[model samples]
Target: MSQFGKSSAKRSKPSYLYAIIGVSLILFLFGIVGWLFLNLKKSGEMFRENIQVHAYIQRSATKKQIDSLQKYIEAIPYVKNLEYITKEKATAKWNAENDTTWKKFLDNSPLPESMDFYVKSDYMNKDSIASLQSELEANFGGRVMSEFQYPTETVGYVSSYTKYIAAGILLFAIILSIIVIISIDNTIRLAMYSNRFLIKTMQMVGATRSFIARPLNVRAVINGLIASGIAILAVFCFILLVEKFVPWLKLLRDGRNMAIIITGIIIAGVTISYASTHRSVLKYLKMKLDDLY
Candidate 1:
């Protein structure tokens, strides 16, 4: 009876190991998704800010008028970057993009000197672009020969597509979060089961509830930290691999974002592990001995 009543714990419990492995894999996956999302957002902004709106200059415009127009556009709050493209430069660019020279198809370069500029990400909208065009025309008078021209249809499609992708990613994130919680909870409870009889034995020996809970909680914290560290290592390795394969992703890596995701993983691991263990221990402590079996 004494042998039966005494808690016989294995010197090494594989339950905790299995739990940690499972949690680590899940955490690593979450980390990768978060990293990708951050980069996608940054890349999207880069693409938007690079969509240049070309304001063609009048062929007869004076150098003073051109310089003044360039200076005025540069001063606009919404403009991110501005460049004055001479007729020669415009023809060269058009040739490079289309594989033919403008002068070959027409008498002289019909292309006018242009103020080519990109707007800030926040201003990359139909209304904003239109307002900018109107303002430039109004301010520069005839020196601004035509409306600022950009690919409105392409911009609208890309905007709509990314919004849908964002929605899908957000939905997946929420669902994955819930799964991680449940998975951690179940894992902790299974691990605590090995100590259930020990908890009741302590209760039988006049140990207070806090006394029974404290050591397990401490162990949970240690386990959580170790698991989180392992996950971080795996995630870092995965990032290195991705950087090797798709080198451009390295350019988008932000220190602040990486730190936040890693920190969040650590916090979530510790909190979930400790809370789940404490709850399981409390639950077993309250159960009748017959019910524990």
Candidate 2:
């Protein structure tokens, strides 16, 4: 019986290797998709934050009044990257961008001093900005904030398509997840096929199902860990290679999202391997001796 079991194990070893490689490839694909989604989300947020809104301060307002208004706007929850653009700073910015000083063309600079801030991505939509504009203009009886302005058309375009892109990626991820599960299940079942006779022989000899399954199940878990580890390493190398060429992509590296994807891949691997292996073992155990042929 020990010799038979040893021979069966040898026959199954090659199949187990192939199964791990196949599952690792599939998991690597899943991790790539997850990384792309996270990058898209981060890029979109940075772009939205770049579209800043300027709250024009009244020229006649006292410094105390401007400071009070700046403090008030800073307290708003949706605000990010707040800056107070003094007339001198604003003039200098325009000059640097246009490559000419305003003083050469006019005695007094025409650029307006304003409070500029970016809205958080979640509140960057047209309606949300409009609501926020209303709230800011209404503050201090509408006298402090002369006008609040952002690119309405740009906001409309960005916010509208963001939803569709997110929906499309999420749908793809869900479908790919189903495919991964099915593929891993099939691969594990195929690997288990080589051990069917050993399992049945053990069963016929009065070995309990659990006792016969214990070693195989343990082997399946170890194989799962190995597969996931290889997949994660492959993914990390791929990311490094890509980021080496496109250095800006490094800015979007989100550790939390990557961790979640890694955890998910590991869980999927272990769960599917164990379930499929156990299912296959039970299936062979229930078959008639003649069916072993």
Candidate 3:
């Protein structure tokens, strides 16, 4: 009965170890996934803000000229909306912005009445926007043209920087993942090494490699699934915390996209778990008893 108790206790200890490792892996994976998701969300917002296009109509243009210009611009594809601001309205806006100085100069000077064209958020970029601006200026000529201002340089610089940053992040994540897998595998291998004699005994008794591999594989999958579940839960909690503190963290607004991201996290957790365990087991299976010692 004492031997039986010892055997059962040994088995129980391994189960607990597996649980701990599984939970650790889950948390690690959750952190990685959450970081990636947040970065992606920020990038999307940047793209939207950077794509804004502003058209300033000429001050000399009459209402009729401006109206014709507005209609012509509206005909183009991807033009989401447009707002026409008269000289009086512009002056009022300036006064509101700089109350004292603008109010004093209001009688002598006049602000230009300009048309503000807001293209569809996505379509407001350098090339297509430049094309549209050129078309507008060419068609209107001296009648209604002041300045077509789109922050092409700023957008381009931001885009280039984002690309480099994304690349660096990707490389770092891959390296980190590799280190994590190797570390976990080593820990599991150490546990298996403690039972190296038993594994060898089973092998000597004619246990097929597949038969020997089955229990380890089963344990690995179970461990992975549990870990993944824990990690996903952690991610959920983190997201909730972020939402509570930062109400503007509205990146995963689309339900479908959020679902996809959650699914990806689960998949990543499971895959990492499986791969780590498989490699660990394979390493031990090929090792000699001397090496185990």
Candidate 4:
């Protein structure tokens, strides 16, 4: 074949530059979604841990009885942290937030003296809190709490929506994974299209399958790394922007889990790119000479 024919064949092939850019964009989206999932889960956990049970202390309880009640609650194994809320303190906090002065209208502050405490992370649920409330009310009775209550509606809300959120995320991720695989495969194949003639030429000249595939595999690996790097850098920048704008989101980050997610992204990029390129090369090597067109 003339040199012009070879050059023309190469030019007919799709641009690897565009292929890389396409793959990188898709991978970047995956990284963002994965990171968001991690943060959402962490945020959910934080919300759970922040959930507190408020046990109202009896107005007529003596100082000795209050001390005993505090000691009793502290002894509870699943308690993460406990706080004492005086009626005066509660009134002040309420006034600060709601612009209401309880002191002037009421002879005694209507707010009850209370024990406010958080349950352990694993126990932050409607059932466990209910059990704890029942136990506290039964154990302390008139000595500590006149009434035991918590944000049951909030716990119920968390329970009601969490599974749905998880399912939606899972479905989105599944669809995203399918998209990544198909798009990357097509991108790599289009890229390999430009090299089909070269592959056939090498095979006709008696190059072994391994020898034909080796350089293409290496190139694929390199391209994959470059694409993964670009995607990761983009996602990292996005995360920084999120943390900057909503600084509290940083509290949900887990270093170890983030590292695992990043590692998975790189591995996925390399695996899919190299496999697709190799498959396309093998395919060209086995095709009839006339199919080179």
Candidate 5:
């Protein structure tokens, strides 16, 4: 009986090896897609945060009012990189960008003092900015203009493009995940095929279902871990190789996101492997000796 079991296991050895390799490749591809999604999200956030919103101060406003407005805007949760741009500074900035200085055209600078700031990525949208503008105007009265200005077209374009890209990636990831699960299940079932006769022989000799399944289940867990480990190593190496060429991708490294991806891959591998193996074992045990042949 032991000799028979050993012979069955040997027959399944090649299939087991192929299953591990197949699962590892699938997992590696999934990990790569996850990493790409994370990097895209981070990059979008950085781009959105760079958009500068200029809240021009009323020229007739007093120093106290200007300072109060600056403090108030700075205190807002969505605000970042807040700066109180005085009239002189604003004029200098304008001149630096334009070919001619304002002094060449006029005696006094026509530029207004402003509260230049950026909003957090979460609030970097048309509706959010409009709401923020309303809130600021209601709170500050006439200290700062209600008509805050920024690149509205740029914001709209960024937001629309980001949503489309994110949706596309999400859809692709979902499809790929389903494919990976099915592929892993099929691979595991094929590996279990060679042991069908062995399972029948053991069952005929009074082996309980649990007794026949426990060892195979344990082997399944080990193989799952091995596949997960290989996939993780491959992902790490691929990232390192890519970053070496496109160094800017290294800037988007997010430890928390990467950790989540790793944990997900590990769980997927082990859970799918164990479930598929045990399911296949039970399936074979239910079949008659003739069916096994």
Candidate 6:
């Protein structure tokens, strides 16, 4: 009886150990996914804001010429919006921006009317913006337009480098997810193997494979749910901590996007756990005890 009690206790320990390990793995996986999502979201937003194309109209450009140019630029597919600043308005804006240097520039001459072209969010990049600038210069030419101004040095490099970084992070996350799933499945399989003798006994008595697999399946799903719930809670807490310390880290400032990301995380967690557990259980069911060694 004491020996049976000792064996029962031993059996219980493995389940608890497996549950702990599973939970830890889930948390790690969730962290990686959340980090990648946040980085991509923030980088994308910054990219959109930094992309701008400025068309400086010639000082002698007539009102009709300015209006016609604005209309033509607005019709472009990649153009999100355009703002027309008259010479007087641009001068006032510049004066207001630089109060100290206002007098120095005010004596020289009037500023030219300028059209600020904001490209569509996704279309903001070196290649697209450069193409749009070239097309504008070709169509309008230097007669009506004095010059085009865009900070290619800083914005171009930052936007391109960020895109590459985001792509690399996404690829890394995918590879990491595959590795994590396989590792978890193997761990679960080893845990199940410890009970192979009992499984064999049940099978010998004419228990169907489904019946034998039911309890393990149920436990796996429950474990997955618990692990996922904990991981999400941890992520939320971490976000809160970041907000407290670094208030600028507002990736999910929009309530709708925040909800969507949270939903995605939960779904990913559950799906990974379900697939890994199902595969591990199925593998064990097909194995013979002699091969188990």
Q: What is the lDDT of candidate 3?
A: 0.64
Model 1 ranges with Cα > 4 A deviation: 1-12, 98-108
- Please, what is the TM-score per model? 0.86, 0.95, 0.71, 0.80, 0.92, 0.78
Ordered list by TM-score, greatest first: 2, 5, 1, 4, 6, 3
lDDT of 5 by residue, 154-267 (tens): 988887787788789889879988988999999899888888888888889999999999999999999999999999999999999999999999888889988988998999
Model 6 residue pairs with clashes: none
In candidate 2, what are the lDDT values of residues 53-164, reduced to their tens digit?
A: 9999887788888999899989998898899999899988897788664467799888788999998888889889988888877775356778888999999999899889
Error of 2 at 233 (Å): 0.7
Q: Candidate 3, after superposition: displacement of residue 183 in Å?
A: 3.4
Residue pairs with backbone overlap in model 4: none
**RMSD, each candidate, Å?**
2.9, 1.6, 4.5, 3.7, 2.0, 4.0
- Clashing residue pairs in candidate 5 (N, C-alpha, C atoms within 3 angstroms): none
lDDT of 1: 0.82
The candidate scoring highest on TM-score is: 2
Consecutive 10-residue window with the lowest summed lDDT within model 4: 8-17
Span of 10 residues, lowest total lDDT, candidate 5: 139-148
173 in model 5: Cα distance from truth in Å?
2.3
Residue 212 lDDT in candidate 1 = 88
**Cα lDDT of model 1 by residue, 41-143, tens digit:** 7788788888888888887888998888888888898886788899789888888888574456787877778888888876786767878778877887575
Clashes of each: 0, 0, 0, 0, 0, 0
As a whole number from 0 to 100, the lDDT of residue 211 in candidate 1 is: 96
lDDT of each: 0.82, 0.89, 0.64, 0.84, 0.88, 0.69
**Model 6 regions lying over 4 Å from their true place:** 1-21, 99-108, 159-163, 190-194, 251-264, 282-293
Number of residue pairs clashing in candidate 6, backbone atoms closer than 3 angstroms, sequence gap of 3 or more or interchain: 0
> Where's the lowest-lDDT run of ten residues in candidate 6?
1-10
